[model samples]
Target: MRHTPPRAVEVHKALLAHFGPVDWRPSLPPVDELVSTILSQSTTDGNRDRAFERLKARFGSWEVVRDGEVAAIEEAIRVAGLARQKAPRIKAALQFITDRRGALTLDFLRRMPVEEARAWLMQMKGVGIKTASIILLFSLGMPAFPVDTHVHRTARRLGLIPPNTNAEKAHYLLEAALPPETYLDAHLNLIRLGREICRARKPDCPRCPLRAMCVYAREQGSGGARE
Candidate 1:
């Protein structure tokens, strides 16, 4: 008999059974969340937090960061890794928004349609589908799904998306496959699952909640067919 790949919703349900409830709500405003997400690229959470705090402490405001010397801004975020690259991108993004909207706040995105807002954010220097979705879903309370490295890998292992699908395309596919209400929980749990069980290097497939339904786990002989 041929095995059918699990649906995204089915995988989501399995994840919930394993990981339980997760809080994915964003406590920060859109702009703050944008900056934080930018800082998160290519860095650990601890380093990202320290870099964010340092930048905020040094600049005092987004406008100052945007207008300040690039070298100074880079110095403030040196601990985040890729500070030279990230600092310019962050400053340019803030400047882009300020130039277009005349302010640093992204409250306007909350009013725009999801796709429109996503497109608008994508126009920024370093923003992409993942970053735009993060701003939309977390900060603006939209239904967009942001696919990071973990979510991308987990989705592929579960066969929720094509094996070769890039994270950028996977974002839309996964978002479309799942109900809007399930996005937050599914996204959060998938990240946790990826971190704890379905890791990139050596996933603990035997103990994975979705192992029975996971194509990768099945191929590895770590999990059997679903009962």
Candidate 2:
């Protein structure tokens, strides 16, 4: 292994070659992005989209979702799973933002520095580092990397970071390696590669551009099992 890890530019180029410019993000309003990110937790995107549609049908606006009855909100989002628990959390977060800032818009946080905005978002209910980073990168167009399970698995398998790196650590390590301009695209691109190519049980190494950089792929060549 090399002393200092290679730059993310090379890694990113390899990733892009394997997964040709994935642009699959939901094109919603920033607040819609926030709500959808919450709804997406512990559920599939399709199911979350269904729940979001139902919620929109029932409420008609973010203000309604923020101020509506918890029971009704939960019912609207039941398809997303754990709606009973997630609904109130979503509504409460929306309410808090609206109350504290007079608007639930992400503009306030977007104006602040990345760290400050991330901290403020984490202070809200149900907003963890992953969620906060998603809000920043996806919604606010800020430079923050949101690492999910797929990213963590792929990064470890490729020897991009240490195997035991938690989501937060992995996020910063990746961010530091790449330019801020690459943060948002890299997040989505890696996710696509993880899902389509570098899968958990059966990574399509032969078809992956990052195979050359992947420790697991090299191990396969040497007849060694993946960790």
lDDT of each: 0.87, 0.82
Most TM-score-accurate candidate: 1
Q: Estimate each model's TM-score.
A: 0.93, 0.91
State how far residue 190 of model 1 sits from its true place (Å): 0.5
lDDT per residue as tens, model 1, 50-157: 999999999999999999999999999999999888989999999999999999988988788888999999999789999999888888889999999999988898
* Candidate 1: RMSD to truth: 4.3
Candidate 2: misplaced stretches above 4 Å? 1-5, 24-26, 222-227
For model 1 the TM-score comes to: 0.93
Q: Candidate 1: what lDDT? A: 0.87
TM accuracy, model 2: 0.91
| Residue lDDT tens for model 2, 1-227 | 32324556788777677566766564676788789999999999999999999999999999988889999999999999998889988998898888778987877776899999999888888989999888888868788889998888888877878878998899888877777876766777888888887777767878777777778888787233434
lDDT of 2 at 215: 82
Model 2 residue pairs with clashes: none
True-structure lDDT of candidate 2 = 0.82
